[model samples]
Target chain A: MAGSNHTPIKPVHRARLDNIAVVLHRPHFPENIGAVARACKNMGIFHLIVVDPLDCDLTRILKMATHASEDVVANMEVYDDLAEALGPFNYIVGTTARRGSQRRTVMNPREVARELIPISQNNRIALLFGPENRGLANRELKLCHTLVTIPTSEFASLNLAQAVMIMLYEIFTASAEFPPDFVPRLASSFELEAMYDHLSRTLAKIHFINPENPEYWMMNIRRFFSRMQLRARDVKIIRGICRQIEWYCEERVERLLREAGVNRVDPEGDCEDRFFGGE
Target chain B: MAGSNHTPIKPVHRARLDNIAVVLHRPHFPENIGAVARACKNMGIFHLIVVDPLDCDLTRILKMATHASEDVVANMEVYDDLAEALGPFNYIVGTTARRGSQRRTVMNPREVARELIPISQNNRIALLFGPENRGLANRELKLCHTLVTIPTSEFASLNLAQAVMIMLYEIFTASAEFPPDFVPRLASSFELEAMYDHLSRTLAKIHFINPENPEYWMMNIRRFFSRMQLRARDVKIIRGICRQIEWYCEERVERLLREAGVNRVDPEGDCEDRFFGGE
Candidate 1:
């Protein structure tokens, strides 16, 4: 009976296959575009939107696509500005090849997915991909609600179609949850704000952060850590680091006085005695 | 009563975190290496090991690390070969950034995590992160039993840290599960394989694929499809497309014969007669 109970899991796999859009920006090669279309098809992602795509024949790329996925190439919409094109979607994330000083906050695809998928179910979801030559511009990324970068080696950027396939794959994998055991445990938006507070408070205590004009510092730190989709313990560990730093700093003044007076310290005795009681 | 029975989740979210090690074979950038450390720490991942990293220095790069995650940079390990370092682990995933021409099968991070996390809990897990310049060379990836890549955009390539964080996050997320009602459904491995086979065979039959000397065509198709990670119904729809193509092809041949003088009358009455006699 138990053996029979393990039914074939087809429906479980079909969750969230639709209601998703893959938008490409300024792709140069037609073949790569075709390949991405094919990849989308292969993955059950039919919505393909190309923003400022190069002047290339869809048929040529479609030729490269598998018969099943060619539909993606056949029915792709083209737009000029990414900001204007991706406006309808409730959630949008950009893919970056490397880290930028300005937009340092980047989260794993799974984390991005966990955060976005719930909202996607209710509203249209769009994932904007940049060019074959240069990735999404800083301006384009700013319009996005979130930013995600695939981890890779420093040199040798992945080819266009290949990049599309990878992100599509990540979306597929991150979205698929096993009903019996795998529940989504992503930090909600409010929790994210709380974590940000913890990070800022800790940074303030250390004096590493300027309280008066901490302009981009907090935003940058917030970008990186927030992108991490941190749980509560992660916040706690970060808080501990701040607490430990402050604790060490306060002890440092007493230790400096003891050392200046050439006081010999006891190894087996009190650490406080060495600092405050002239060693 | 059900609501009252629910208990608060404790903050010790350490079980899913692995002693993950990034074994790079000759990294080029000090920044990329630093970024990898940042990526690890951001995801609440702390272990980092580099094998023969090129032109390395942790002091200069640790500034890029945001918090206690800098410890990952501080405690980085450098090794000569993989086996010497990897002898301590049971689960291993090698990152492959370079596109493969020979049809090498690479699992996306989700599947790799599903396979690795359970085994790692029983043993120390070592994830292989290749050089920042050329990804895991094929030889390096061969050392790993399983190969994985982070999915990016169509023309996208990623830095080493991004890939590591994605993999680690997936593995970490899989282990952080709740009870029965929480998990969403995902397609099983068997269904994914079946879908792959069906898509491949159907594509072959269509004129879309060259019947002669089908070199990397099938492979490219498979590679693209493999990235899709299709759900069961997604596969079913694809299979349905294949069946429609077969049906259309049969009808098309019959119409061509009528034009060329084989049938002339254009048989149309009985469905069974139309099917068999169309030949």
Candidate 2:
């Protein structure tokens, strides 16, 4: 439990939070709406949409929302229909507590928060919360691109504002960028392909690999190098070693021929026989 | 986005929840107390303690606690003093909205929840919340071993129940264990040193590294291989390659010497001269 005094503070991507709109579909209580607004404001979310609420009493809502979240309540949009409310958003995530055969795909809030980071860059995302008494129906869920469930105990029922608070908390926390551990740009596919080709030829020339079915041995070589995630400089270093091996092998063959007083020789065929003869 | 139908549900450690108690110090409203109780029950935390409340009406508290959370309200503890209320708990976390020089060690709720998992296993942990108008004072915070602040926007004021809900939600969700992604045992320092030594000799024999200052070049090589986080099997593979290179260099030098009718030769000196002479 070290103090966070030494820990670096991560920068929050505020624009992502701005892109998220909290839509309460068919909410039953005005106090819950106000509470949701406060939760949204607490987590840096401003867009609050209420669709066809049973009660839209501003006094009760404002009471729970308090003065701090009044702006969220002031600019909040009220819609007559759920589909019309979600029309402007590019992506919709429906929240549900009920699990059924029909609701096959359900993600937890943390996973949804992480996944939304990329999508929120260019899209308006809506987090749709259903009425307190009954969660989003299968019909309403159909409009959603994804589904999220807040994990709870055997008493799995959560308050409307509580659910909203949890979901928003995750998004707000996830929006922060972790302290960077810089990894340099790795070699491109084209550069890697050329290096691998050069390595294949050099290994064959040295009789370190079978010329026949070279691809089989190359597969293992590829996996090994892939794990390294070699940068361009590493690729160049590997290629230089291959070139050196080729030069050494050619020079040895020429020196041997001169010593034996042999004018002509199939270097490849002769070297293969001489290298593998002992084996 | 893939459907979570394939995602396995993680089991929540309920005993951890049982170990957590939510303490309200000098609360203003009974409604907030009731809401906090519901929030605790929603997230599987049952223990609720109130200390020197402005008002503690059972009727008003029960109204917000709802029938679902009645059991939590029935077993709630009330205390006149904060210090006496926190006596049974081994760890006390004070929540604050204000940041100051004295309160330099503030953690967000998520970090606190994650940290509490191990501590909660053997000890009782208390999450202390202050009154609605002013959060925990510096004097009250002194009683706490650690301090946590709910991260919020410019409008930092958050409802008491919302704050309680967020803290409990984090604990409940974090209690679940994630699916394991196993990493095999890596090569020990002794094994890695052996591989590096073998590699150094093999590279020198092939004239791929400068023998005069091999360690300088070996530093870069070490960094490259370290990035791969080599396993025991990977170390074995690398050592095997070094052995192959050593055998190839030796075989080539031996055959060349025999053909030249040399009974014994300074292999290292001759190889160095022959290899680097052209360069």
Candidate DockQ values, in order, are 0.01, 0.20
Candidate 1 regions with alpha-carbon error over 4 angstroms = A1-279, B1-16, B98-105, B152-156, B178-279
Query: Against the true structure, whose TM-score is highest?
Result: 2
Q: Where does model 2 exceed 4 Å of error?
A: A1-15, A176-279, B1-15, B178-279
Can you write out model 1's per-residue Cα lDDT over A86-187, one digit (the tens) per residue? 756645677776665443446655566665555445455677788866788765665455777654432324455555655666666555344332323434
lDDT of each residue in B57-150, candidate 1, tens digit only:
6664664454545677878888877778788876677777555642678877767777765566566777887765457666666677777766
Model 1: residue B49 alpha-carbon error in angstroms: 0.5
Best by lDDT: 2
For candidate 2, write residues B1-279 as lDDT tens digits.
376778886655533778999999999999999999888887888999999999999999998998989999999999999999999999999999887757379998878988998899999999999999998888999999898988877888888998898888888877577443246688999999999988777666566777666676678778878888787877876776666555655566556555555543344443433223111
Fnat of every candidate, listed in order = 0.00, 0.42
Q: What lDDT, from 0 to 1, does candidate 1 have?
A: 0.57
The estimated TM-scores of all candidates read: 0.38, 0.60
Weakest 10 consecutive residues, lDDT, candidate 1 chain A? A270-279
lDDT of 1 at B242: 46
